[model samples]
Target chain A: MRTLLFLLQKEFLQIFRDKNLLRQILMAPIIQLMILPWAANYEVKNISLAIVDHDHSTYSQKLESKIFSSGYFKLADYCASFNDGYKLIEGDKADIVMEIPANFEKNLVRENKQKIFLAVNAINGVKALVGTGYLGNILNDYNGELRLQWVQPSKISPIPSIEITSMNWFNPGLNYKIFMVPGILVFLVTMLGSMMCALNIVREKEIGTIEQINVTPIKKHHFILGKLIPFWVIGIFVFTIGLTISRFVYGIIPVGSIGVLYVFLSIYMLAVLGLGLLISTYSDTQQQAMSLSFFFIMIFNLLSGLYTSVDSMPGWAQIITDLNPLRYFIEVMRMVVLKGSGFHDIQHQLIFVIIFAIVFNGWAILNYRKTT
Target chain B: MVAVQLNNLSKKYDKGKIVAVDSISFSVDKGELFGLIGPDGAGKTSIFRMLTTLLLPDGGSAVVDGYDAVKDYKAIRGRVGYMPGKFSLYQDLTVEENLNFFATVFGTTIRENYELVKDIYVQIEPFKTRRAGKLSGGMKQKLALCCALIHKPSVLFLDEPTTGVDAVSRKEFWEMLKRLKQQGITILVSTPYMDEATICDRIALIQSGKILSIDTPDAIVRSYEGSLFAIKSEGMYKLLNDLRSYENTLSCFAFGEYHHIAFRDKMKNYSEELLKYLENKGHKEVEMMPVIPTIEDCFIKLLKN
Candidate 1:
C-alpha cells in the first residue's frame, strides 16, 4: 500500500508539474462541452425555397402566403419561369421550388381540378422529404376550404378526424441540447481517462524512466493501480463539471437518480483507462499513442448512437453498435435522464459495461511486462 | 559471502538468434568494486540488467545477495540500486521530488539515509526545486546517482553512468563511488572507458557477448607481452604505411600522435632500422622509442589475440 501511494504521488506530481498537460486536460473538455452541443443538431430548419408563380391569381397568392407563413421554408427568390427556378436551385440558392400552373384559379372554379408542381432537391434526402410533406399538408388544407363552400353542412361535418397527441417524456419540448449534453459528457470522460493515461505511460518509456521503476521493489499491480487511479479521479471530476453545466446552463435535469449515473460513470471510466493502458503497452512512442487513441475515439463516437438514433440505423449497423461500450453508456444516459429509468431498466447495459471493463483491464495487466 | 554470483548465465533475444549475453560466469564478493568493461553492444548492459533482476537469463542461474534473480526478484529489488545507461530519472519532477520518490519506493526517507547520498546530493542541492529536465548534463548525472543511493542498498549496479559526462564530473563521480565502497557496499559498474577501468578492484573485458579477459586492471595491462614503441615522423601517414611494410614489424597501430609497433622476435633490433627506412622515404625527424602499454594498448592486443 505504501508503494502504491508513492507511485500515485509521483504520477500526480508529474501531471501537475507539466503546465502543457495541465492546460490540455482542463481546457479541452470545457471547450468541447460548451461548443459542440450547439453545432451538432439533426433537426433541420429554414430551408431556402424558390417560387415560380405563373397563375397571377388570388389563389396562387394565397398558396404562396401559406407556404411562407409556416416558418420552415424561406422565400429565397421569386423566379418568373421554370428555367429561372431551376437556375436558383442549380446555383445552390434554393432547396425547393414551387410552380403554380397558369389559369389555376379559373380551372379550380370551372372544373374543380387544378395541378401544382413541387420539385425538391434530394441531395439531403431527409430535409427534402420533410419540406415536401409540409407542402402537401398545406395543399390538403386549401382543398378542404374549397370543399366546405361547395358541399352541404351534413357532408362537411359528418366525420371528425381523431387527433393523435404526443408528449415527449422528461424533455417535453424535445430540446436537442438535453439529448446532446449527456453524450458530450461521456466523450469528455472517455478522452480524459484513456488518452491521458496512455500518454503518461508512453512518456515514461520515451524518457527511459520505465527501467528505473522496474528496478524498484514496487509490485506490478501496485504500480499499475497507482497510475490508473489518478486519471480515473480526474475523469470523474471532468464528468461532474459537465453534468453541472448541463443542469444549470442547459436546464437538463436527470429524471433518474444522479447517484446511479455516477455509479455507471465510474465503471465506464475504468474501462476507458484500461483501454489506454492497453494502447500504452503496445506503443513505444507518444505519437503512436495519440494516433491510436484518436482512432478509437472517432470510431466509438460515430457508432455510439450519440449523434443518430440507433433504431433509425440499418440492422447490421445496429448489431455492430452492440459491441461499443460508448453505445451502452449513451443508452444508459438517455434512459436515466430522459426516460426516468431505474436499475431494472439499465441492468443489462450495466452488466455488459462491467464485463467489458474487466476484460480490458485483465488484458492490459496481463500484457504489461515488468521487465523488457 | 558473494554479493552477486552468476554461473554460466546466458540470454538470447529473437529465439536464440541474437545472443545478448553468452554463457558466462562471474561473481562480485561483498564490498568489492567490480567493473564490466566493454564497448557498446558488448552485453555489458545486458549483464547488469540480469543481475538487477530486470531481465531473466535464457540458461543458467544467478543469485544476488543470496537470492536467486529469477525466483527471488522481489527480495533482490529491495537490496539493489540500479542506474540505467540512459539517465532514466523522472525529468518532469524536481530533483528533490525524484529523490523523495525513489526513497519512498523502498520504504525509507531521505532524512533517514541522508548520510549515504550526502556527498553527491550536496553538489545539486541548490537546484532542488528546479525540474530535472532543465538541469545540465553534469547536474542530471549527480541527481541520478543521488536518487539511486537514497535507499542505501547493499549493492549498486551502475550501467555506463559516466558515459556522456564531462571529465571533471566523471572524476567526481568515481571519487563518490570510492567513498560509497568504504561503507561496505558492493559496487558493480560498467563502462566503455578504459581509463575508468583502472579505478575498479577487478575488471572484466567483454566482447561479442563473451568475457575475453577478467583480472585486476594492472594485471591485465601487465599481461600485454611485447616491446612496444611509439614512432612519429614528418610523413606520419606514409611512415605508418612504410613501417608496416618492414619484415620485422609484428604489430602496428596508430595510438595518439605515434605508431605503436612490436617486432616478430625479441632479438631483432628494429627501432633504428625502421627509423632509417622512414628517413630513406624522405621522412623528417623520424623518432622511435619504447614505452609501456596502457589499458587501451592492452585492449587492442587482447582483441588481436
Candidate 2:
C-alpha cells in the first residue's frame, strides 16, 4: 500500500508536469460537450419543396399554403408545369415536389374525391422519408376537412375510425440535445478513461522506464492499481465537467439520484481503465497502444447505441452490443438522467459492468509480466 | 560463496536464427567486482539482463544471491539492482523524485540506505531539482547509478555505464566503483573499452557469445605466448601493408601512434633483417622495439588462435 502511494505520487507528478497533456485532459471534455450535442443532431429539417399547381383553384392554393406553412420545408420553386417542378428535383435544388392535376376542384366538388402526386428525391433518404411522411399527414388532414365541409348535418352517417396518440414520456419535446447530452457525456468519459490510460504504460515502455519498474520488487497489483487510480480520478473529473456543462448550458438535470449515477460511473471507469491497461500490457510502444485503442474505441463508440437505438439494430448486432461497455453506460446515463431511474432500475447494468470490471482487470493482471 | 552464477546459460533471438548468448558458464564470488569485457553485440548486455531477471534464459540456469533466476525470480528481483546499457531513469522526473521513487518501491526509504549512495548521489545532489532529461550525460549517469544504488541491493549489474561518457567522467566513475567495491558490494559491470578491463577484480573476455578467457587482468596478459613488438615508420599506412607481407610477421594491427606486430618465429638478428626489409620498401625513420603485451594484445592473440 505504501508502495502504491509512492507510485501514484510519481504518476500524478508526471501528469501535472506535462502541460500539454494537462490542457488536453481538462479542455477536451468542455469543448467536445459544448459542440458535439448540437452538431450530431438526428432531427432533420429545412427540406426543399417544389410546387406545380395546374389548377389555380382555392383548394389547391389552400393545400399549397398548408405545405408551405408546415415549418419543415422551404419552397424551392413555384412552377406552372409538372416538368418544371421535375427539373428542380433533377437539379438537386428541391428535395420534394407536389403536383395537382387540372380540374382538381371540379372532381372534388362533383365526385367528392381527388388525387394528388408527390415526388420525393430518395437520394437523401432520411429527408425523403420524413418529408414524405409529413406531406402524407398534411394531405390526410386536408381531406378530413373537406369531408367535414361536404357533409350536411341531416345526410351525415356515422363512420368509425381509430386515432392513435403517443405521449413522449422522458423527452416530451423530443429535444435532440436532451436525448443526446447524457449519452455524449458517457462517451466522453469512456474515451478519456481508456485512451489516456492505454498510452500511459506504453509511454513508459518506449522510454525504457518500464524495465527499471519491472526489475523492482513491486507487486503486479500495486503497479496496476497505481496506474488505474490516477486515470480513474481524471476520468471522473472529466465526467463531472461534462455533466456540469449539460446541466448549465443545456438545462438538463438528472431526475435520478446523483449517488446512483456516481456509483455506476465509478465502476464503469474501472472497466474502461482495465481495458486500457490490458492494451498497454500487450503493446511494446505508445504508437502501437494508440492504434489498438483507436480500433477498440471506434468499435465501442459506433455500437454504443448513442446515435442509434440498440433495439432497432439487427439481432447479430444487438448481441454484439451486449459486450460493449459504452452501451451499458449510455443506457444507464439516459435511464438515470432522463427517466429518473434509481439504483434498483439500473441493477442489471451495474452487475454486468461489475463483471466487466473483474474480467478486464483480472485478465490484465494475469497478462502483466514481471519477468519474461 | 558465489554472489552470481550462470551454468551453460544460453539465449536465442528470432526463433534460433541468431544466438545472442551461446551456452557459457561463469560465476562472481561474493563481494568481488566482476567485468564482462567485449565489444557491442558480444552478448554483455544479454548476460546482465538474464542475471537481473529481465529476460528468460533459453537453456541451463542462472542463480543470483542464492535464488534461482527463473523459479525464484521475485526473490532475485528484490536483491538485484540493474542499470541497463541505456539510461532507464524517468527523464520527466527530477533527480530527487526519481531517487525517492525507486527507494520507496523497494520497501526502503532514502534515509535508510542514504549511506550507500551518498558518495555518488552527493555529486548529483546539487542539481536534484532539475529534471533528468535536462542534465548532462555524466550527471545523468551519476543519477542513474544513484537510483540503482538507492535500494542497496546485494548484487549490482551495470551494463556499459561509461560507454558514452567523457574521459574525466569515466575515470571518476571507475573511482566510484572502486569505492563501492570497498563497501563489499558485488558489482558486475560490462564495457566495450578494453582499457577499462584492468579496473575489474576479474574479467571474462567474451566474443561472439563465447568466453575467450576469464582471469585477473594481469594473469590474462601474462598468458600471451609470442614475441610482440611495437613498430613505427614514415608512411604508417604503407608500413602496415609492408609489415603484413613480411614472411615472419604473424599479426599486425594499428595501436595508437604505433603498430603492434607479433612474429611467428624470432631468430637471432631477425629485428635487423626486418628493419632492412622495411627500408628497402621505401620506409624512412623506422623504429622498432620489443614491448610487453597488454590485455588488448592478449585479446587479439587469443582471438587469432
Candidate 3:
C-alpha cells in the first residue's frame, strides 16, 4: 500500500506539472456545457419560404398570413409565376415554395374541390420530410375551418381524438447540452488519459530512461499503478468541473445522487487509465502510441453514441455499444441527471463499468515489463 | 558467489527468422564489473534483457541473484536494476520526483539510500525541481543513473548507458561505477565504445549474436600477432592504396592521421624499406614506424578471423 501511494503520488505530480494535459482535460467539458446547447436544436424555426400566387385573391393573402403567423416559416419572396418561385429556390433564398392555382377562391366556391402545390428542398431529406408534414397539418386545419363554415354543425359528427401528453422523462426541454456534456467529458478524459500515459512509457523507451527504471528493484505492478493513478485522479477532477459547469451554466441539475455519480465516474476513470497503460505496453515509439490511441478514441467515441441516441440505432449497433464502456457511462449520466434514477435503475451499468475496469487494468499489468 | 549465470541461453525474434542471441553461456561473479562489448545489432541488448527478465529466452536456464530469470521474474526484478540504452526516465517529472518515485516503487525512501547515490545525485540535486525533459544531456544521464541506483540492488544491468553522452560525462559515469563496485555489487554493462572496454574487469567482444573473444582488454590487444606499422604521406589515400599493393603488406587500413599496415612477417629494417618504396612511388614526406594495436585494431582482426 505504501508503494502504491508512492506510485500514485508520482503520477499526480507528473500530471499536475504538464499544462497541456490540464488544458485538454478541462477544455472539452467547458465547451460542451457553455456553447453546444445553443447550437443543437430539434425544433426548426425561422424557415425561409417563397409563395407563387397566380390568383392574387383575398384567399391566397389569408393563407399566407396563416403560414406567417405559425412562426415556422418566414416570407422570403412573393412571385407571380411558378418560374419565379423555382428561381427563388435555385438561388438558395427559400427552403419551401407554395403555389395556389389560378382563380383559387372562385374554384373553391364554385366547385368544392380545389388544389394547391407545395415544393420543398429534399437535400436535407429528414428536414424536408418534417417541414412538409408541418405545412400539411396547418393546411388541414384551415380546410377543417372552411368545412365547418360551409356545412351544418348538427350534420357533422365530432371525430374522436387521442391526446398525447409527452413528458420528456429526464430532460423536460430535451436540452442537447444536458445530454451531451457528460458524454463529451467521457471522451476528453479517455483521450487525455490514454494518450498521455501511452506517450509517457514509450517516451521513456525512446529517450533511454526506461533502462534506468528497468534496472531498479521496482515491481512491474507498482510501476504501472504509479503511472495510472495520477491520470485517473486528473480524469475525475476534470469530470467534477464538467458537472459543476453543467449545473451552473446550462442549469442541468443531476436528478441522481452526486455521490453515486462520483462512484461510477471513479470506476470509469480507472477503465480509461487501464486502456492507456495497455496501449503503452504494445507500443515502443511515441508516434505509434499516439496513432494507436487516436484510432481507439475515434472508434470508441463513434460507437459510444456521444452524438446520437443508441436506442435509435439498429439492434446490431446497439449490441456493439454494449462492449463500449462510454455508452454505459452516458446512459447512466442521463438517467441520473435527467430522470433522477436511483442505484437500482443504474445498477447494471455500474457493474459493467466495474468489470471493465478490472479487465483492462488486469490486462495492463499482465503485459507491462519490469525490464527492457 | 555468481551474481548472474546463463547456460545455453538463446533468444530468437520474428519466429526464428532473426536469431538475436544464439545459444551461449557465461556467468558474472559477485563484485565484478563485466562488459559485453559489441556493435549495434550484435545481440548485447537482447542478452541484457533476458538476464534482467525483460525477455524470455527460447532455450536457456539463467539464475539472477539465485532466482530463475523466467520462473522467478518478480524476485529477479526485486534484486536487479536495469538501465536501458535509451534515456527513459519520466521527462515530465522533476529530478527529485523521478528519484522519489522509483524509490517509492521499490518500497524504499530516498533518504534511506541517499548515501549510495549521493555522489551522482548531488550534481543534479540543485535541479531537483526542474523538469527532466529540460535538463542537458549529461545532467539527464546523471539523473537516470541516480534513479537506477536508488534501490541499491544486488546486481545492475546497464545497456549502453553512455551511448549518446558526452566524453566528460562518460568518464565521470565510469568513475561512479567503480565506486559502486567498491560496495561489492555485481555490475553487467554493455557498450560499443572500445575505449570503455578497458575499464571493465573482464570484457566479452561479441559480434552477430556470437562471442568472438572473452578476456582482459590488455590480453586481447596483446594477442594481436601481426607486426603493425602506422604509415603517412602527402596523399594518405594514395599512400593506403600504395601500401595495400606492396608485396609484403598483409592488410592496410586508414586510422586517423596514419594508415595502419600489418605485414606478413617481421623483417629487420622494414621501416626503411617501406619508406624508400613509398618515396619511389611518388609519395611526399613519407613516414613509417612500428606501433602497438588498440582495441579497434584487435576487433577488426577478430572480425577477419
Top candidate (lDDT): 2
Error of 3 at A74 (Å): 2.0
In model 1, the runs with Cα more than 4 Å from the true position are A149-152, A155-164, B241-251, B263-267
Q: Deviation in angstroms for B272 in model 1?
A: 2.5
Select the stronger candidate by TM-score from 1 and 3: 1
Q: What is the lDDT of residue B202 in candidate 2?
A: 97
Clash tally for model 2: 0
Top-DockQ structure, candidate number: 2
lDDT of 2 by residue, B82-123 (tens): 998788899999999999899989999899999999999889
Q: Give the CA lDDT, 0 to 100, for residue B162 in model 3.
A: 92
TM-score of each prediction: 0.95, 0.95, 0.91
Number of the top candidate by TM-score?
Answer: 1
- Candidate 3 wrong stretches, greater than 4 Å: A152-211, A303-306, A363-372, B266-273
Lowest lDDT block of 10, candidate 2 chain B: B263-272
Candidate 3, residue B176: Cα displacement in angstroms equals 2.8
